[model samples]
Target chain A: MKFIVSIKMVPDVYAPFQIKDGELLMDGDRTVLNAYDASAVEEALVLTEKHGGDVEVVCIGSAKASETIRKALAMGAAKGYHIQTNGDETYDSSSYAQILASFLSDKEYDILSFGKQSQDTDSGLTGGMVAQLLNLPYATNAVGLEIEDNKLVVKRQGDSGQEMIELPTPCLVTCSNDMNEPRIPNLKGIMASKRKPVESLSVSDLGVDATALEAVSKVTSYEPVPARAAGKKFEGEPEEIAREVAQLLDTEANVL
Target chain B: MSTLLTYVAISDGKIKRSSLEVLSHCKSIADAGGMACEAVIIDENATSYTDDVQKYGASKIYTVEGDAFKQHQNGSLLKALTKVNEVAQPSLIAFASTEGTKDVLGALAAQLKAGVVADVSSFNFDGTKVTAQRPMMAAKIMGNVNVTGNPVLVSVRSGSYDLKENPATAEVVSVDVTVESGDLRATLREIISATGDTIDLNEAEAIVAAGRGVKDEEAKALISELASVLNAGIGASRALTESGVYDPSLQIGQTGKVVSPQLYIAVGISGAIQHTAGMANSKVIVAINKDADAPIFEIADYGIVGDLYKILPTFIEEIKKIKN
Candidate 1:
């Protein structure tokens, strides 16, 4: 069993940022492995380690993304494929999916995985798009993964419940961050990661039509979410305030 | 005239109210733009939902029914949606953002070669282009997006719009789509339904969410009692879910289900940004925690600083009294 998990380096959503003139401003250097992708990589590594296989990672970003790939390598991924981009192009989920599809078109692997959605945009589109392009059996929002008798069984979070799905080889899955906690790189693993092989390629190198990679959707501006004003606070006897608020819910708030 | 098609989602044998909300918005858009408003219901009992869909003003309804459509299998759903798209030739397709929609939205858009925007809070589709506002960076910021395609696709978040009734005489059309077993590359082995009869959090009018401070079975019982009184869905923060105190299906946060019920009650939960991101859109928020400065209080419409053990019993009793 061979695993190729698509990884990404995304803006640290926790970093303080500002919106001015409909533009989002944040520290460009503050980037990290997407948490959901890290979970995908972690799950793949766990499965391959127990099942006597190897885990590899693929990422699409600028040269700085090699650091992200290295982080996965430190988590014991055997190899990395860096699909280099200009880092300035306003690529949407579709563009990234096309690039990944083109790169994986000629590759061999048993399972393909991705984060359920990007940390920054949270569009959650690319994995299914790539799966469609490659015509593979796929599942999304996977909270758990298991390999059984040459099949990938996924426990995916659905609207109503957790659906246990089984996909044959050459399948795709998008992992949710709820799956598992990603392992931090140990000192020895970090040193080994520095020596791990990282194969780099440009989008043009994949033979995908440049026009097809053009973004069909563009983010025109960024705006702050409407703030919810804090309301009345009640700090008194438990029974008194509790009854008071309950009355307010029915009378004042009209919700009850 | 071009058509605006809304996909009516069915979950647990009932049509999702969020889907009707999306249909209502699309109907208004179609009425204002002089375009045809249509709907597609793909379910085991798709035709049974036509009357309910008609109430939302869809002039034409497409039904793709079969046992294959019983559970959400992306392969069968994609095939059915493709056939409907071909028959409807809609200029824009709208959906209520659900886990099912998230599973197949990308693949459907890719198959159709259409532009797509996912989990948008609000969207507008003119004759040519579609513009949408979607939450980004864990709902801390909103991104205004412009989409271009012959048939643009968009999925709106639940509670983004109010449901409106605009009755119409709908022409029902049955779409024929046979999904061979060979085409279903993935097989559903089983479904682990954690919340069997509990109200779905996404559709609940009110939610009672337990956090770390809800430690013991006693507290859990109190939480359940409170929910029972208010008819609210039970939810949990990641802490409770990860610790196995609550089912993962009931976890509400950035990495879990995002909910916007009319009323949200947080019990013993210190409000983290990740948890707050999911429920910040609730119409009225009430947080009860011993910590006076808990961040959940920042956005809570009614912040009660008290111990859950003491507060919940009184809260439940008071609500029950009000109801009687």
Candidate 2:
């Protein structure tokens, strides 16, 4: 079995972001592979270890994304593939999906995996678009998977419970945040990653014509959210507070 | 100018509150354009919801009823809407931005080879052009999206539009259709039940949520008070519910319930992605936290940097006065 997983490098949610007000701020201390995509990397490792096959990680970003490719190599990916771009422009979901779809259209890979959503886009739109473009089976929020009769038996997340979905070998699965625990890389693996194969590709090389795709809306600016108004704590008997609460609910919210 | 509006309906055997909110939003857009607004529903039987559909201001109800149409079958829905657009030739298509609706429509747009204006807070028209407001960069920035296409795809963020019953009589029109092989091929195997009350969080417009920062005694009081005041349901963070500070049924996050309400109030929350993933689609977010640096502040439209204990009583009084 051959597996291909998509990975992305994102800012640490805890650290104040690097790009604020459409201007450059110094990059912060920590940057990691996306949480869901990390699970995709780990799942590939687990499956490769059990089935004895090749696992590769792919990403579309600036040269800075190599930081995560190195992480994936340390986590046991056999090779790293990066398609570098010189611009800071962020493509909308449809355009990004088209670029990736074109990249994978001719590749004869058996399994394709990606994170369910990306925080920067929080739109949860890419993975499914790739599958639709490829005309292959697609599933989201796959928590578990197993190989049986040359098909993939998977567990998908629903609003409240789990659902089991089955698809053939050439299928796409998007990993949810809770899919699996991510593996930590040790010093030995970190040192060994430099020796692994890393290939660089470009949008021009892939025949990507980005000019045809237009942006309907642009994120012109960002501001720190305003603070909330003060809340008043009521101290009294539970029943008394409850009655006042009821009055407040009716008068203010018009709920009662 | 033209406008597109989308309504989300919660179906078990019928349409729900979220559905009307979507319609009211479209009514606003249509009123601006001086055009007819149509409400579309996907269900097994169309007539079950006729009276309420028009009572809620939908001048017309377009329903595709049958087994294939139930619970948002993405493939069939995409096909059905394509036919509807071909027939109606409307200026815009609107959606109510439900969880499944967002996912399904996002995919549908890619399938239809169209761009989507997602989670619009509000929209305006000027006889020939339409402009709508959207939140990006995780709700910190408010941006305007202009639609130039003849028929654009737009979805209203949950709780963004207030619902009203205009009560104009309208008739229901049904479309006959079939499910396709490509449609049934995706992974929508089943709909599982959440922990307790089986309450549909997606249908709620007002949500009151509490977190671990809520000092113990105040934790329980917060829910009861907020729910009573807002006529809203209660929700809690996984941390608080796991430590027995609250019931698990109230837990909201990546592993719990995902809700999109009109007014989302966070009490004592630190605003981790786990919790934000559940309610980031809200129309208005207000956070009350003592820690000014809490991540919840990153997404809050209004954040009160004070002890909730010192804040809730007075705030509630102020709200009462404002409304009165």
True contact recovery of candidate 1: 0.91
Q: Write candidate 2's Cα lDDT for B1-97 as tens digits.
A: 3434344364566566766777876777687668777777666776677777888777767777777766554566666776666555567677765
Candidate 1: docking tier:
high
TM-score, prediction 1 = 0.99
Candidate 1 root-mean-square deviation in Å:
0.8
lDDT score, candidate 1: 0.94
Q: What is the C-alpha lDDT profile of model 1 across B274-301, one tens digit per residue?
A: 8998899999999999999999999999
Question: Candidate 1 regions off by >4 Å?
Answer: none
**Which candidate comes out best when scored by TM-score?**
1
Candidate 2 residue B151 C-alpha distance from true site, Å: 3.5
A32-64, model 1: which lDDT tens digit per residue? 999999999999989988998889999999989
Cα distance off (Å), candidate 1, residue B119: 0.2
